[model samples]
Target: MRKIILLLLLSAFISGCSSLSKSQIETVQQFGEVTSNFSAYPSAIMEELAEIRLKRGLYYASTLTDPMRHLDELDSIYSQKKYDYKVSEKIDVTFRVLDKYAQSLVLLSSGDYTANLQNNAAEFGVGMDSLVNLYNVKSNAEKLPAGIGEALGKIVGFSGDRYIKVKQSEKIKEYVTKADTLVLIMTSNLLEYLESSNLEELISYEEKMIRRNYLTYLQLTDTGTFESQREYLDLKSNLDAAKDLKALTIQSTKDLQAAHKELVQVVQKKQKLHSTIKELRVFYQQVAEIRETLNALKKDK
Candidate 1:
């Protein structure tokens, strides 16, 4: 009777150990999977965000040269209304994707946790509640700005196509500043997450995206064709500067701070470029209106 009891006890202990090991493995695997998926969300969002910013910057630059010219008419346009609408639509699409992704993550994590718990009935396990909280954090982060881009699209009206000369105007500058600030916020938020996760590969990817965005902005602002040596040189210089900054090693806190400072400078430059474009746009519109009036008077005569 004593030997039989000892054998039974040993079997139960072995089973408990096996159950615990399996449960731990499941938790780690689930955590890794979720975090990896979560990391991709910001990268996707940033790509769109960068494109919007660059487009807006180019539009502003073009408008600065000719106040009478409308953005839609420019070879490269910067109509807030159009951009905003597109951004809004994109936001809706992104939100839906995020919603589905979050839901799936929750279901998977819960299922895994539940199965593990059942297998180890004697021990308390990490609840699905914690995983739910993680999903909520990611979802909220992604959902907040989907509508703002759309709202901006509705406010700007059609101006016409002409090469607007760059002008220095306060109101135009203000709008540019506001738009650039929004972009900065988006980029900063993304960088913060990447930095926190210490994911070097993702950080490198983001840096490349940022550089591409800046290059697009430069291209839009340059009015002279590829044939214009001056314009080409200017564009090349800006591109090189942007690329150098992007490639710089940022391994320490100091490096990050320096990089941030540079980013601020870039935002300021974009604001200035936009301001110049806006002034030109307004000027071209005024000129075109005058010309139309003159032609109408001639016909009346």
Candidate 2:
């Protein structure tokens, strides 16, 4: 009888172990930069609302309350950070976290997961801390890295589809859905202000007055004699340019109204996004595919 012994050895590639391609890095940077100007939109509406309320009086007079009550309500929403700022800051922080994840993935792709994991993990926690600070609800920053870890886990599994499915957890879906909801609320209020208040008329009147002033200025410049013929010709040329501003202003107001109407239609169509989980899954999968392509690029390099 002969004694027999068998042994097996295999290599496992850890996640984030490839070098990144230029396009991959650019995509990550671009994705990070794409963010909604949530606060600006609402702030603009509030400013318009306040101006119109002062110029034309509040949207409507209540049977009982301060006459500026409606304007005050808008002010309160803006000042209290109940919606606009909340939504804006929240989305911005989310973008930051995503950028961090993208960077961490790059590190992993570079075959430096274990060495960089500690510091990368710390950055993720800090990012989450910034994020949770914006919300009224509580969240542990440590909880965030777990998701990053899970995403990193996909490296070993080598299954992008499965990884995407894992990202579609209920918690993540709810967060994405709620973020979208916040935007809807912010935009809806703007449309409501436009429809219910005197903002449209106020804006139009203000623009009309501005155009009138430009015309008045043009007449004054034309009537005045210049020291030289070139001076007079230059003034005349600039006058044409100044007159064109009136047309631009008109177009700007029309464009605003068009955007306002389009937002209204979108809100009507996808009221709450009951399939929020599916939406998130699809979105995350796209991000994942980008990451995958990035890994492949680095590997080829």
Q: RMSD for all candidates, in order, please.
A: 26.5, 16.4
**What TM-score should be assigned to candidate 2?**
0.28
- Give the per-residue lDDT digits (tens) of candidate 2, residues 149-204: 33333333223432322222221222222333333333343344434435446445
Task: Give the per-residue lDDT of model 1 (tens digit) for 170-193.
Answer: 112222233233333333444454
Question: lDDT value for candidate 2?
Answer: 0.35
Report backbone clashes per prediction.
30, 8
Q: What is the number of residue pairs that collide in model 1?
A: 30
Candidate 1: 10-residue stretch with minimal lDDT: 160-169
In model 2, state the lDDT of residue 228. Answer: 30
Compare the candidates by TM-score and give the number of the best one: 2
| TM of each candidate vs. truth | 0.23, 0.28
